[model samples]
Target: MAKKARVRDYDQFIVRLPPGMRDRIKDKAERAGMSMNEAIVWCLEREFPAPVTLEDRLEELATMVSMLTDSKDTYSGVVHLIAEIEETLDAIGTKGGIPADTKFSDMVRERLDYWREIELDSWRDRNESPFDDANWTSVEEPPEGDPFPNLPDDEMKKD
Candidate 1:
């Protein structure tokens, strides 16, 4: 049990957070045997840490801004690339035809399939291909001799 403090007036504030965050916070508070207000206070204390110095805070803010800027730049680049690709494809379509002459698409698709098949079989040795011993050559060896002349298997074994 703890002593209760009386308050003359309390300030009320409303904020919207991502869905399920509030529910998760409430669940955590309930598990910790504390009220939602107490849990929120604790969480805020942890989340909003005290910076050692103004410079440290400023550096953190700068890093956050840089990250945001980088994200925006990357998104813009991707959008540009997609637009360029679409334009190129549209140009190709216009140069060719809408349905692409049926035979052309079919031939292109068949060629692509044939290329894929070739890639798939690139590492394989076909039955028709002879096993050429081009690099097969035996190395000269020394005369046969006892590898372990000083040691015996019975002596090496431990009881």
Candidate 2:
């Protein structure tokens, strides 16, 4: 067994409360099986776990909104491309799960070629003058303080 450390006395700060609040605190303390001091400490810690600052939260929210907005425009295009690829692959029916023929292989290759051509066209368009300028935004200033809040107890132990 480990030896217990000697208890040290700390300065106590006085606080003012309404007349009946003390009684309520005593009752709550009894209900929670804690002393008034322990209850107060518990309340303070639970309400104010800190690591990330409010500025961080605000910036995080802004970043999320921006990503969500961009994803709205991009997701459908991705889904359509995936569906087209799936349909083309489905058309190339399997012999023991491997594509059976040179003809089917050629068709799949053609579909892939078409997909690559579309991607190249998109890259070219984005790289051109006006679109290229619009593609990136001015960088924002760095946050002043810690941005992430403390993880809840359960999350602290997870992989």
Candidate 3:
């Protein structure tokens, strides 16, 4: 006959349980598919798990903040782009969905085609003079005399 080597190598210790506690532990052990000892150890481990350091929490928070910041930055541009797309669709006389009517689809396609044609040309033909300081009129200070010199302070204060 082969010798049955003990699987558990640790020294055994006696633990006193209250009345009905043993039965409860047995039930839990059966439910968990573990022995009473294994179930007790599992429960204790779960109840008192490893302690988390402040550094670990700070790192987790930093990762979360970084992810949120990245998402915010990306979504900001997406919001503006979506708005522009909606506006474009509205201009073409259709909501941002597939049109049931073939005529409406054709109209949308035509509008898109026209826009595409003019888009680059418009960019190329942009009036650079508007951006030039030479073309801009400098703001002059208001005249020393009030334009409404005839108007009294009381009249100006009237609702």
Candidate 4:
């Protein structure tokens, strides 16, 4: 038997785009090969993302700190930065964002996991490592001291 079609209970809005904006949206929709509505929604989602839960924030901070600790100046800073791009590329190719013939799990992944939480799929996707409590720092008490309090004023002696 064929599967039942998924119901789309989307709210409708009639937007008035100025001058070339409509054409731009249409072009983007065409390039991404998605419906104008889908393209618009993708843009909106990227622009106004959901609030980061406290757990998520802590996880991000932990990941950054762990990676930083392991590296002389961030273990794989380039990859980390690329992975931390401010925008999501969901509408890069097709309706699914990824190629129609490809599955997300099958895509090439170069992982560098510093910590892990098995229960969360997002955490698992980032790569998994056994958690260590010692790698954490409390936000309430940050490290003290300024290495350069008076620049261009304090002279250093060659010892």
Candidate 5:
């Protein structure tokens, strides 16, 4: 039986290449395990990418907007954290000052505790609105331990 011929939907074109270009195409085709025509098409596609359509541009813009919204949420969280630290330092000074030998870890732990338990209460004591409707605790809880600890996953003790 006669083998069926290959049918292509693409238009055929005849072109002349510069010296050694034909050999380069042949080498690329051999390395990639494709025909010389395929190699040429691949090279052309690589050098000239498809144009972005209106829908593509809108999708890209939408992605950027989403990223910005995430950034804003993160920024607000950080700002609230700094404010909590300031309040804690003020409370410490008024109540009994920290000992000179207090470790940085202790301060971090205290800040975290203050954020968790005492934060809302402290606001109430100071006659500040809890902003109960838009509480940070509801949005993003503070980390319990070092977020980027030096210890590896296996070395670190899990709770």
Candidate 6:
């Protein structure tokens, strides 16, 4: 039986390097336990990574804000934390400089508006709804009638 020929999976490209670069690449490749082509590809991938989008950053910030808001701390503490976060975001915007198409402040204001809407909805749910029973009692003791009358007394006893 004849052996099958190996297929080349990738296209070839001719790259011209400066003097001594080829030897350096060969040495580095050997040290890394990879072929020259693999080393070059790895280097290129490391140097030119995918860029982060503004949407991704906004989502990250939203997640952080949600976490801050959801903390069990006091309202004042939550407000202070949010203020610090806003200041940090402002500093980042100042450092990076605003883009021509979209301002960082505009994005922040949009997010704030969304948060305000959520808070308003929550407040309305708590205060304005007729179905909300603020005086509802906790179930520390069992009801007058046993929910599971058929269950054994031993099973119903608290530890």
What is the overall TM-score of model 4 with all chains considered together? 0.32
Instruction: Give lDDT tens digits, candidate 3, residues 1-159.
Output: 557778686567799999999999999899989999999888787997655433453465456545656685755554454354444344442443322455654675677668767765775578554545566465654345665445678998894
lDDT sort, best first: 6, 2, 3, 5, 1, 4
Backbone clash count, each prediction separately: 0, 2, 0, 0, 0, 0
lDDT of each prediction vs. the true structure? 0.56, 0.62, 0.62, 0.53, 0.61, 0.67
lDDT of 4 at 113: 32
Model 4 clash pairs are none
Residue-level lDDT tens digits of model 5 in 1-159 = 557666575668899989999998899899999999888888789997665433454465456556656785855665555564454344332324432233543575576667757666865777755543343344354345765345577767674
Per-prediction TM-score, please? 0.25, 0.27, 0.30, 0.32, 0.32, 0.34
Pairs of colliding residues, candidate 1: none
The reply for model 1, stretches above 4 Å from the true place, is 1-8, 48-159
**1-159 per-residue lDDT for model 1 (tens digits):** 446756545455687879999899899999999998889878887987543332343355456545656685755554454454333333333533232344544554566568657755873544334433343343533235744334566865643
Model 4 lDDT, full chain set: 0.53
Lowest summed lDDT window (length 10), candidate 5: 93-102
lDDT of each residue in 1-159, candidate 2, tens digit only: 557665465446698988999899989999999999888878877987545433454465456555656675666656555554454455444433323455755776687779879988997877666524265464553334623234465875683
Q: Model 2, stretches more than 4 Å misplaced?
A: 1-11, 50-159
Best by TM-score: 6
Where does candidate 4 have its weakest 10-residue lDDT segment?
108-117
Displacement of the residue 94 alpha carbon in candidate 5, Å: 61
**4: Cα error in model 3, Å:** 27
Can you write out model 6's per-residue Cα lDDT over 114-149, one digit (the tens) per residue? 987898899788778563345445445444666654
Candidate 1 lDDT trough over 10 residues, lowest sum = 91-100
Q: Where does candidate 5 clash, by residue pair? A: none
Query: Model 1 compared with the native: what TM-score?
Result: 0.25
